[model samples]
Target: MTARTVRGAVGATLAAALITGVAACSNPSPGGAADAGGADSAVVGIATEPESLSPLLGYGKDGNSKIFDGLLTHDAEMKLQPALARALPEVSADGRTYTYALRQGVKFSDGAPFSAKDVVFTYRTILDAKTNNASKTELDAVESVEARGEDTVVFTLKYPYAPFAERTVLPIAPEHVAGGQDVNSGDFTTRPVGTGPYLLTGWSKGEKLSFRANPGYWGGEPAVKKFTMAVIKDDDVRLTRLRSGELDAAILPPNLARAFEKDGTRTTFAARTFDYRNVTLPTQHRVTGDLAVRQALDIAVDRGAMVDKLLDGAGKPAYGPVPTGSPWFTAGTERAHDLDRARRILDDAGWKAGEDGIRVKDGVRASFPLWYTSGDKIRQDHALAFASDAKKAGIEIRTEAGTWEVIEPRMKTDAVLAGGGSPADPDFDQYQLLTSSLGGDGFNNMARYDNPTVDRALEDGRRSGDPAARKAAYDTVQRELVKNPGYVFLTHIDHLYVVNDRWEGLGTQVEPHDHGLGSGPWWNVESWKPKQK
Candidate 1:
């Protein structure tokens, strides 16, 4: 899904009315709110509003997190743990099929009994061409999903998919409720029912969404009885509301986290390999397609400076799609801001500096539009910083801001800031982004990047049953990708969430990317409790 599509609903509401000034007051002091009686009704705020409640249809992390429960979840270390499913699926001898035994009596928020049927339905719908599910590429290897029994679901794969179990992170939907209807059609996309800890209480299109605790959760009862997710797109407004106590917790830019740290409110930073902000260079674009121009853009970028100055050292310089900390991360890659090298590469490629300071090649100016979602403050800052750096290299980088609707189609011909990541594993993250066939039809491969070597490595990694072999396969892919420069590696950001210090046990994993609010940090909402005096 495009960032615009994800932010459109929230943007419309934010435009309609000014946010009421809420008191910028804490409950009492640090850890004081824990003693308050209504701690059960903890209120959290997210920077962006969710696009859809349905897990299958919602590809963005912001929205899918609220209403869906994946089969497995990752801990702070990226270790897989059971969320909806009882445990990780058992792989067959041939490594082609996976069997998962369901948790005893999980029920959907609607009180419908959740079983193997729901799991079967969720996967089948995604694999079905008619569903037109955004996540269809993730399930391309799955040949079939069948209910072995009332509590067991088995998956037959077309090939030995090493990340098959990790794919369980996709939330399951109730078969009975979602029966006979096209997955992509109708009101279900907006209004979805799932077996997560939270139940969708109310959604006002562009305003806010309210969720109540699902008392029927099989795991345990949640401490937070009611939660409200307001779609506040403006960074200033989101931070303001967070400080004013209008929200118990809020997702803030990395720079703002340090500012809030001085206050009693607790700010927690988790390392993630899941998401990175990269400049997608369209090979078809006249200016960006030139190898020298792409290399110049890469060398001109001061990634370390961007992280230290803009992000307050909360993120690491990205070498490639894989973050530095991930197991599959290839170290010693060639990424550095060398202005001399940039100038040499551009000059050697027949691109002479013109009177306007922009390079000119065959009557074409060395300038292309860099698109970013308008309201995102961090992206805006990154774009400005990137443009400033590129200017020093004699390359003209024109920046544009718009919603995803206007930007998605343009991605085919222009460069844009693409944010993507997943904490599960390498296959879960890389394969979907780089493969040619998976490009136009898949998740967010807007760059239309295609490489035969990368594709071979991806397929080898997927088919390999041995853990060591799979890691090596993915490692090779990362190394090759870094060499090819399909994407200008930017930075792997640490997600910062500022919350009232009253509550404890807010479980969050150091993700490779954001798993949405519901699945990542908020996955264990049922176990969290307000500390007693």
Candidate 2:
């Protein structure tokens, strides 16, 4: 397909919104008047409003965390734990089947009893072609789901997908509430009901969202009384609000989080995350289209310097798609800075350095606009640093911080500073963003990369559950991808948050790209307790 068509198709959805999460929240029971105790409520600042609360949309970008309960949830350490389910899922040794035992007597916020059917409906909706969730690929391994009984839900996967358990960290919506509605644009998209510990009391859109505790929560009453998620897109404004006591907590860039440490306004909570940040080089563009230029761009970046200076050493350089210590991480993928080699590679590829120090090939100057969210200081810093490093390699990188709406159309031709990764494994990490088949879904494969070798290895990894086989397959994928790098990876950021000390239950979270306001600091708000008198 042509470049323009690709951009239009992919940019329409993926860039719009989506992501992973937790479930629960506070007092006055759900929907009761914001009691006189509203002063004790926890207010958080988020960078974006959620695209939708429907689990079909991966619980959205906004982090309305308390309203939905997933079959599985992550602990503060990011390890898999049971939420709606009674306990950890039982996986078949063959790797194709997963069985979850529903927690009996659990009730949705609306008072409906939780059932295995809810689990079945959730997956069925996401897999259905009519469902509009762009992140459906996260569950692509599931071939079928069946409610074997009132308490047991079984999932049959197409393969022994290694990351199947983590993918279950999705909200299980009540069928009685959302069943017949349009799965794509249903009432549940905005108004949600699940077996979570809180109810979504209010959503003002672009302003703030309100929540109250689910009194019938299976886990017992949460200590927090009321919860508010305020949308503050500007990084500085978010910090300012936290200082002024407008918000009890906020996620800040590493530098900003560090600044607040000594301010005494809020205590910084830094957590390790699989949130991988990389610059996608769209192959459709002439400047970035050249494979040699892409490789040189990879070598040109000083990943260590970006980590040290930009992140204030709060992050580690990302070599491949996975974290450094991950079993799937390919050690050979990590490389040291070699600027002379980068320039030589470009020169050998027929790119000639002009008098102005910009590389030119044919009639095209090696220049393209790099896009990022304007409010994200992390991406902005990464972009500026990227441009500086590219200049050294005679490749001009013009950084543009456009709103997602503005950046969507240009995703076809421009490079983008994007962030994503999964709590699952490398499959979740690589499949959506790197695969060629998933290109039209906004953020997935925005780079427009196509390589049959890498594709086959990725397929192999997904199609088998044998550890040895999967390892062999993924190992090949890493090596092949590094040989023709599609992204100039910078650093895997440590998600940082600052919260007030009024409550005692807040804990660190293993965040994903889809972190919502509720998903981070508020993951277990229901468990937070006021310091005892």
Candidate 3:
């Protein structure tokens, strides 16, 4: 959840409530209450409430990217497109093997089929270590995958990765029914099976989830045949159920997208290639393990008044974890906001300034515990505007919320709201959020931030199979994360949604970082229809 911590919580209460009204809705006039010619069935609507439907233990990309289908997908300009693998693997003049081909008559809305032994039983159940899979360290350089026949599927690599085709957007599963079971002891991860184009059907966990359109999809059936989601974690009850229409599509909050565009409804907004929001830090905490107090709280926050009064201008800032239209971002690097150079870098590190204005030294007190995820009213307005800009630089933050099962076991002793993104590449969002021993001990680095130049630029950007040496090793790991700031860049959002003009193929070629509701705008849910006056 980036954009400087999702606008210090819902972009400053949607720029203090923008409110406009009537953006679009004349399309049905002639004989309204329409459904005339057959097709218009679309139902999309979301605002969190999908913690898992098992696209390999889901981690929010809005309802497991619509009942799962990866093996390559991201298109609308975020590139790396392919889906269910038909191309984009090849390599092997000794780049340590890696074939992939399979795309024949795909199936699986339980009609089964989709082979290559379901991509070698979904990368050997995510490189089994008792299948605990949270992308087991992003497939830890697999040593094998086999199959080589029913539509081919090779792999082999223990080395030459080059982001192993962005870990083929993962979602294969089936080897004649999830091979030898124990995929992390499952009720089949709360019932799952893939191939895509929507399928789930029902769920109540939390509140709602439902879907339908698969009819043995090989890329055909879905034209929105009933897809409900509903898990409303209250952003004012998801903009009062999208302004009482009970949601035709939601996710509001840019001050309710100008009050649902003056209560009429259309809102578009875009930007999101995912950096949602950040503020991590932790690098072995103790008043945030000083790196000059995390570069003086990243030069004393502010990020252009949190993108013009809490993101009504949407969002942009952020300098590190890539995202500047990524191709490995980095251009012209600069990050400032001074506060007297953040109080002369905490008065030359001696930290003083106490008596309530915060900043103590030996007896501690700069303060920590930001965390988030509870009722998330835009991360409680970005944790009360980053605790009023870290209490004017002397620090003292404090705000916790909870439930990523109690903030994933206190992200290695606090600092939350991470929100990442990928339109399919930058090594599938920086090798699953900065690789380390992964899937074990303090996962997703929750700011444990170890760096040997970001672990040798994530192991030479995954074994550089040349794309200009993996964009000069991810532009030298985004300029060594802006000279070692280690998560705090924040702001890169754009994703708005709204939709109610009877849904005509809502943003299809897909990409603004696949804005979750299932892999960004429901990854072309078999070409959305719903407009038949």
Candidate 4:
């Protein structure tokens, strides 16, 4: 799974055509004009849209990609299930080689026969240096991928990577279609053909993505024929559209989801997730770079209060990237909210209180700007609360709001309220987030954290096949984060979604931070059957 920047909480700047399309749709209720296109259609409002629909550019890498199917797919329980492959891959004793027997008679949406060559092409293209897949590093364990005849694909690894099987959940692309064009900026990036149940009909960028069921789907065609994902960025707007029968479902924040609880027509679903929101204290900043200031801010903020008040009890305090409920989480690494301890740490480090109560060390004020994306209510609230908490410890934090374009460049010297996590494996997120070599490499390590001990531990955890050894290595990484905290880990949020109760088999899975697209209650939408009236 890719550790992508959480850019979901969005702005509502839709095109006029999108507005007309949404307004024309009616939901299942008395006195309504009509459903989107009757019961066979579904219009959903999601906050963010993918930059590209092509799997090679890193879309649907975690599965549930309506437009694409991975070699393996996750069931409702999130367990690995065969999709493109006939069964689970056969692993060699050394855990370095994996062989998958391709499913017979499966074809891409364009009628191209799915075979071992397509599988080999997809992996090789992603690993190519010219291709700009940011999450390509996740597949660094692959030494080679080859096809034996038309039915079998084999992957050899450089090391004994324990979670190599989980990485195969990556969606495969057709070699016949994608191989002939420019891999980076081809027509396939927008209009894609895959082995998945849904086919892309149209994509109005920043507005909506339209899909129709693939009748030739190997798994069986979806009952819901037409699926339209409205790109309404604002939370309030999404709630309005859902209420007005313009949208059948929408992913909402905890506060917005509360409004639908009393409505008999709609049902709210909450999915437990590894998604966490944290403040990136950039190591290049004069004040934040100080170990004392970083340590103070880590314990000073009230994570419990953020979960209670901001999240409205829809989440838990996150001590690190690993959720406290997860077995991977190490005990005794929890940080208590201690204002006195925070102040003392700053004071002992030669930071003295100025006349206005702000701390100053070596004539430099302990103040830095903190930015969150505009129109994101949850992030804005968290940033404000963080600034307030830091004030109590004699540190000044100035909170700001901007788009990612404005915030990305300033990340090296300023703080950002960013989000990321993956339930697939610890190495999935931790490696990209903490590795020293990944620092300043486009959202990989926004804080530029460079602890040599942590770097070694992360490598050991990902390379070792032994379960005990992996656990011990990750434990060391978590403990070291306590001593030299790079990011102030906050609340691990549970994704909340509101949908009309008109379909059976509609439920949510444990989601990643990059939800809405491949997550929410509609994760298994293809399997859903309309409720008999």
Candidate 5:
């Protein structure tokens, strides 16, 4: 999923009532009686500071906002559940409206009573034209939000969006504190007041964020007393801290994480992280724009070897948009590498190979620069490895490390090594990646793909509520997606996390694009307790 949409747009980073306490004594592994989280607390190492704590901003998008909460929340499994809202919405027969009944007696960290007004206000702010949220597109389907009573809030949609429930997963801002203020620039962004189990107590700007358990939390008191996320920008530094017991939990790239398995510093591998890495082929570029060339790249790359060697058996090769666990995954969506077929396809398309082995078509060399974010070692490694393999197929792949600021401007003409996936709805995870309407901005579909079949399938999947129909729609989309590849689909990285064994109740679940601070392994941190001997 993605900001550009995960129905959670990748990290989230949305609607909830699915809040239920894990069995207080159900230790994930064999352990003694653990002290319930009261004054008990620990520090975690994170790579990036949260962009913002404001609900209108990117803070809660990773699905781990310690302060704010919405009517709905998700469980460890990512199923929609109740947090502040009383329960899941009551959908209207027409499917354009969703009405939710607010939970009673719940108060924000600052003691402000939560009401349906808060929900309406939060939704309205997101829909506001002046808001600077990258995910404003996520709320575009909502035509209006109504507070029918003190406890009732209803949403009317512009269309029958099947992922509407998923879209409602945003963290609700406190209408009392955030209602009239200019959320774009305000003190509330940093000093947020929330209704969840934990309250933000301190932010050390680029250093750390600290929180304390909320005594008034409706879900029984949170066991974790003091939660601190230390900001360590470098992976090596973070791991170094992890080994020294400075970090209670840390997310590591596969290559680095593999080493922690035997260190007694416990590691949790969240199996099907919908997150996948792919090479985005900008459709406007002559070398990449041709359908044959896209297909040739797909066949030429050795996805299995990349997973086995680069990822250290921590990932699954991807051929299509959706990851394996999703119901929409098809058998032939990703095929084994066939360099011979790739070569034939290129030659038949009239591309002639030069003396140096790069193909040429219509006076244009079959070569393009692939861009990856500067900091991600995995992306860098993948890019360099891909360049090495593509040479055998007579394709010149130039790998470049650039920041998003520079790469965003040149996405239409340059290739990018991108990653994203969501554990929510199938349409939520892959729709924007192929929609023709989203082609120009290319927020998700950076490759600028506009296949009519894929577009219809995406719209159909979102416009209907029928499970079978949605499945059929996505199946059609995938079948078509494989034939006209937009990205050289790589591997779905297994989210690897290392945590000290001091705490009980640490469990693994599917992860999103955003890691470390949010939904990786700490989503249910409030339920943790010290391992009893």
Candidate 6:
């Protein structure tokens, strides 16, 4: 459940096919990774790169960090599988205590032994207030983590958090390597040592992340010996590189993915994801802060048309973070695209249309700047479409494009075309998104949404272990959004990738919103094998 509030705003190129490792090629030009490595190496083109490689700083927090192993990991079916831990943790009767038996003889890529102490250090350091991890609150259920001898570790929870076991998927860092230095700004942040299938060789920010398979990996060494993730921010540029053979595989938007449909050499893989694109309505802004404006905008947007046109039938219209097909979704919570109802709501709220056809209320025009990350064609299309839809309802929305650097500062008062979702559990995404305490806390609540009822419901949903109780709690949260809409949810997009059909064992997972880095068809890249000639 790594919500991509910051990185989502950063332009990302999607993943396409199984990639062989590339040598360090920051800019995608001819003579890159595709030429350097043979069949044993693979190179992939992705849109974005992580800010830090360190697990301590929220990298791999949702599992599948290529450089590190978590206590548990999700399989192809999105089910939990043991990694550092020998098996699933033993839960207590009260559901407040969890005990894990460490997998013995496992060592980090740097050749250091992995033990219960390493687990303790990772959890303790992240939970520390001084550590600048924005995701520490996800572990708020933890009361204490104690090491039992060298082989066992135990976690005590403050409440019977139902998804506490899921949270254990967080990657563990070596205590000896990360503990001695500054947890926030340390060499380990860039050069991390972990017990995973690969080792980080180099990270060229805004360019590429280079990796080599760990020879001494606990799970046998990868068949693809070298791997490089070329960071190409523009979708068209990524497609160009992929077409020219500079990239082996890459994630592309649905419209762009169609270009390779007739190409026999490449196969397109469409992964079902919980990724939703929504517009953040900042509560601090005079226009977006109004309940009437929020409700009208929510209903005025045509989500079905967006799915049909922008996504080209690759995704479904979204009503909220929980997809309509999801069992957790409330049946009656879907918002209809009713232009008349939207006009009536605005009219009743005293927003009168001027001679210019723009709504004005009490000398303030119903207009605000909406920002999307520049160079992202998908986001640009969504922003343009949203602005067009809003125009019909007498509202003037000015859509702008900028990098996250320019947009982050204005998020408190301006709207943003934001994307985020998690397939794990409702609590995984909803708690951080809807909690009142997390408002304006660095991307936790980008809209600065503060609703007491939704906040209470999120707390109850996460704290309770009972399935019925959690369902009812989340139902309330969704229902309350209908009455007081904070974000205009657009679509739940399926991740589409095109890849060179060069390897076996290539598949996709039920991905989160934050894809490209640890998702796409190459999520299980370690298990991939070169196809026989």
For lDDT, the strongest prediction is 4
TM-score of 1: 0.89
The parts of candidate 6 lying over 4 Å away from their true place are 1-37
TM-score for all predictions?
0.89, 0.90, 0.36, 0.94, 0.89, 0.95
Segments of candidate 5 deviating more than 4 angstroms: 1-39, 265-267
lDDT of 4 by residue, 177-256 (tens): 99998776666776688999998876766677788899999989999999888888899888877888888998999999
Consecutive 10-residue window with the lowest summed lDDT within model 2 = 17-26
lDDT of 2 by residue, 279-382 (tens): 98888888888899989988889999999999999989987668786777877778778899999999999999999999899988998999998778788899
lDDT of 3 by residue, 1-533 (tens): 31112112232233223211112112322211222122445444565543344544433322236666767755555456667778877879868787878788888877867878777776766666554445455566778889877888888888876666666676666666556554543444446677787766555544556667777778777767766666566667666655555556656557766665555446454535554567777877787777777878776887777767677767777766566765567686658777788778887988877888898888887888888888756556666676677779888888878866567667775777566765545665675566554421433556767667767777777776767877877787777766677677666666666667665666633233334455435556567676677
Q: What does each candidate score in C-alpha RMSD?
A: 5.6, 5.0, 17.8, 4.4, 7.0, 4.2
Number of the candidate with higher TM-score, 1 or 6: 6
For all candidates in order, the CA lDDT equals: 0.70, 0.76, 0.63, 0.87, 0.75, 0.87
lDDT per residue (tens digit) for residues 317-400 in model 6: 999999998899999999989999999999999999999889999999999999999888888899999999898999999999
In model 6, what lDDT does residue 263 have?
99
Candidate 2 structure, TM-score to reference: 0.90
Clashes of each: 12, 9, 28, 0, 30, 20
State in Å the error of residue 328, model 2.
Answer: 2.3
The Cα RMSD of model 6 versus the native structure comes to 4.2
